[model samples]
Target: MDEPEPERKVNGMKSIFEEEIKKIQDEIDIFKSGSPNHIAIISEPYSRVEHIYNRILGDNSQKINNIQIFNPVKDTDFFSNFYSNQDIIMMQNCQYLFSRKCCGFAILEEFLDILFSSNKMYITGWNKFAWNYLKEISNIESMFQEIITVPELNSKTIMNLIMSDVSDKVTFIDDRVSEDKKFICFEECLIRMPLSNKEVNISEIKFNFNALKRKKNNKTMEDIQKEAFMDITTLAGGKYDVARKIWKKSLKDGEVRLSRIPQPSEVEISDIDELFILGNILAMDGIDFDELSSIVKNDSLLKQKLYNLVNKGLIEDSDRFYKIYPEAVNSVIDELEKNRMVW
Candidate 1:
């Protein structure tokens, strides 16, 4: 993990921002024409949020000509210096301005109010998980006139997006399956708990028994790579960054193997404190270790839990900032909801 992540320098790789540029063009034009429209762009993490923001500034034909792009990640005073001459404000990575304070309701209330009232068009980016949490607690979604999400890609789209990054570098040598495979018995697989009327826990997990049949489909080497690429994309929930990580992990001996595909490491949660920390981290999208340590009542215990979470692969840290993996976002959200850490 000490290795610094190299910049994504793959050739022929389509920028995630390219497809959505024209989709929001009309709205951007409308905003420029004095129509009050605050556009909110939300996406999962590792979705290249910065890249998208740059693309907006770089794409000349989008019609919002000669607008100063303001990234508030470092300059908290950027908004304070706003003048009427500036018609558009690009607020990138707004999550950094927020924390777990007051369940994050108190984070952007005043600034959002200002943006809504002013004639200026505010284009903002946010992590979907954090955005949803804010919408629930602060009713912030209503403030935005228009919201667009970076699309969750399928196998075909993922191939078109990132295939060039791996093509010609590695050849498909063999086909492999999951690391462990066994026929699951219906009775054993069915999970049940008593209804609320009774003193019991009732949880039923239904499996598609019919979908278990393995079909006979012969594929060429190129087709198999496409299939593997799609599988990784699906497993990673079409997150381009996470899909690339899984792809690189699965490649061995200059070949791709089905079994090498990765999943979030499962951790046994006996303590409720760990869940609390994780929920807040998800709510903020990411938090610095120092800031988190200050927030937790017990610094030593928080450090221990953070180490455990990192070792278990439920979360990863970079330069003391920690964030959940894209594939695990849903599961983390589920855990938070189940624990009543979030409403």
Candidate 2:
């Protein structure tokens, strides 16, 4: 009898930071050639800069033999045992060096002083929001010679990244009916009249070319796969972790369905305290209750406010550490930017 075919399944994918790793390695090469400047890798809060740092060290173990790594948890005393003999220093989650409260800059100032005076080549990972905020308030931007911002993954890259882990063939299914997958959509918008400067509400018809193409041509297997991955990419905002989360949720019985991808619910934040709390959590990537309380300092209503945020599905509490929900990161960022809480 012939050997049985492997069962179709969707397996968890390892994060791929190919371009990011290349850029970091290039900077390391330049540093090895007597360059005095340090390197900084900045990314969105949910992007998980630690993974990139690990990838760099893993890929270039022989080249970077004498490197020290540190991940600070609090605003002070975390870097007391720095190795002076190491030529390379890798610091992940540099955003934790400072809090957003009064007198929070003491530790950050100290760290910068050491960074500036030290002759060793430093490679630091930072949260983009925190980096931008620190740049405005401090001279942190000038300290790093090479600042590499991780760009969002495109649809094709996301598809490859997610599919790389699968051991067997998977199917893509488009189960939506004609009405559900309409090519045309109407959106409400305010436009000024040509003569009068009066604003008017009008419905603008938008055409989804991809949907139209699918409807026009005979749907092929490749078409379905592309559509499913595109939906996942859009919902994830091209972030690798977010896209992987969505892909896992969308996969059922070895079939990826476009309609199964989840979208974040609309979150409205009118309270100033809630907005600041969200921004602070994002800037730090994740914060424990004690640290958050130190910055917020609203003991009476802190618990209730956190409860409200969790109930609204805007934030998540894991082992007393509060973090913006993965699905809600983009929404939270937009809200914070609108409120001028984070850059």
Candidate 3:
């Protein structure tokens, strides 16, 4: 018997998640075999590192024990006592251990000392931008025995992930014109001649006959879904959170049209204060007002800069914490790089 659609989608998403978890598990297994080195999992803001960490603990509950999870916020005290019976420690958001100010490394140094001296196994999650900065300024990279960078999801995986969780019936509408629906295209490429050692520009015709046939008739639900998600994935740069945000925006009254996928607005950042504020937010992943104020030093100036950023739709404030908007992560990163604020 054929599997139900929801069940099939669940299984597909599970397979993709398992594939990602397996890579981390393999590295963990090596550490479990009496390796002295601890593990570090790093990824960009809004990536799947935290989700994977939780899944690992949940899935291995029977086999893995004596584990404690710690999620630290700004000005967190790392000197707190650990459970004596706990054999493994998992620390999330280690970026909050330090600020971007003078004497910022004090807490980080203390934490590293505890980490290095402890006999228990350690697992840490870090913001990728923060990790890079820390690596450049300090010897933090050498401390981790194994480092795992979370992989980005492809268009197919993103589609499966989004669809699997959707219980409501969603209709995918293909609103593209005939020209936009073309399944064949011509492209020019440079090829080197083997004997002459010279390159020649050649035009090549590429065809997707199956897609063409579908276009002539009615497109299958699967084909329409793939095309919509492909556009979403490209716009999201394969980040799950960004893709999901796009999905939610595209959906209206249980219908998702191809033309409804939101495009990222242009971000303009010229002020030096705005650049610094954005850099701090990106590096810390998510930070509260006080912590950010500590980095910026001037409370009044910081408030105005953050307000401007929020108005620009480049970042959002939740409670007291500020984070880059899911869709604007790439744009913010590009702006920071242009200003040489981030490496």
TM-score of 3: 0.79
Winner by TM-score between candidate 3 and candidate 2: 2
> What lDDT, from 0 to 1, does candidate 2 have?
0.76
- Summarize candidate 1's per-residue lDDT along 235-303 as a digit string, tens digits: 777777777777777888787776567645434466688888887687666787766865686788998
For model 3 the local lDDT of residue 231 reads 90
For candidate 3, write residues 225-262 as lDDT tens digits.
99999999878877888888889999999989998886
Clashing pairs in 3: none
Candidate achieving higher TM-score, 1 or 2:
2
For residues 1-343, could you state the per-residue lDDT of candidate 2 as single tens digits? Answer: 2221222221233555667777777777777533457888899965645556666665554444322323235544565545455567777778888888888888888888888887677788788999999889878888988888988877898888778878778998777656536788998999999989899999999987878776678878898898888887777777877888878888889888767877555667999988988888898888888888888888767788888899998889988788888888888887889889999
- Candidate 1 to truth, TM: 0.73
Task: Give Cα distance to truth, residue 100, candidate 1, Å.
Answer: 1.8
Question: TM-score for all predictions?
Answer: 0.73, 0.81, 0.79
Whose TM-score is greatest here?
A: 2
Which residue ranges in model 2 land beyond 4 Å of their true spot?
1-19, 32-35, 62-76, 180-215
